[model samples]
Target: MSETNGAWTWRLEDTSGTVVPVSEEYADQHFASQGDAESWVGEFWRELAEQGVVAVTLFELDRQVYGPMRLDTN
Candidate 1:
């Protein structure tokens, strides 16, 4: 998918590829840039893991750019 001009967002999910429901505070995070989206996840991935988010998928608008990236830093 094209990586430019579209909104960047994350699809939080568990290992089963099921979407995980995070708290409202993090439920609506959308970014104008991919770096921002990556950075946000980098910062909060620990917390997300604690809350059962085992993986994440990146999307640009409705098009998935990449992922199902595991949050495990091991």
Candidate 2:
């Protein structure tokens, strides 16, 4: 994950801790703000569920923001 100039890059991973290949729409995109990054997950997590992703993590450069948050597509 990388954050620069108040933007962020995200990584999606599986439960086994392997990085999953996110589609271009969600890959390598820099978010405008931390809240924006988190909101992206909030809205897009169902897609992650469909892709067999069990959890998510947020980072800002080298710092962990939150997560490995379990997906609940109920």
Candidate 3:
């Protein structure tokens, strides 16, 4: 994963070993960088946790943003 200009626009393999984008909108918003978006995502998750959301999964694809990406119970 690589970032440019404090924006996150990289692909990472999830636990499933699938490579995907952190977020498409973020990529576009940040000019295909991979820092700012990641930071935001971290915060987003944190907020969800604070809201009592138990499980969350974030998914992506090569330049494709696909999720929260999934949520699980138990």
Candidate 4:
């Protein structure tokens, strides 16, 4: 079953674990399913990394599914 928008989202952060401020237009970065969220991150992670986002955490509402996954390709 799929969750509502904002139910499945990511918490982007830098290497120091500081939350990265997302632009207002990108604030609604929600997904219906985990796969959808993962795919979106896979596609845009490079751009995010470029913007100083070194890691990301997946969330289901207030629940953390998994992550703080490093964006480093090394």
Q: Count the backbone clashes (under 3 Å) in each candidate.
A: 0, 0, 14, 0
Error at 37, model 2, angstroms: 0.6
Ranking by lDDT: 1, 4, 2, 3
Candidate 4 lDDT over residue span 1-74, tens digit each = 22344479988998788889866544458888888889888988888887778999999889999999998889
Error of 4 at 15 (Å): 1.0
What candidate 4 gets wrong by more than 4 Å, as runs, is 1-4, 24-26
TM-score of 3: 0.27
- The residue-by-residue lDDT of candidate 1 on 1-74, one tens digit each, is 23345499899999899999988777768888989899889999999988889999999889999999999977
The better-scoring model by TM-score among 1 and 2 is: 1
Query: Candidate 3's error at 58, in angstroms?
Result: 7.6
Clashes of 3: 14
CA displacement after TM-score superposition, residue 42 of candidate 4 (Å): 0.4
Screening candidate 2 with a backbone cut-off below 3 angstroms (N, C-alpha, C), the clashing residue pairs are none
Query: What lDDT is obtained when candidate 3 is compared to the true structure?
Result: 0.39
**Whose lDDT is greatest here?**
1
Per-residue lDDT for 35 in model 4? 86
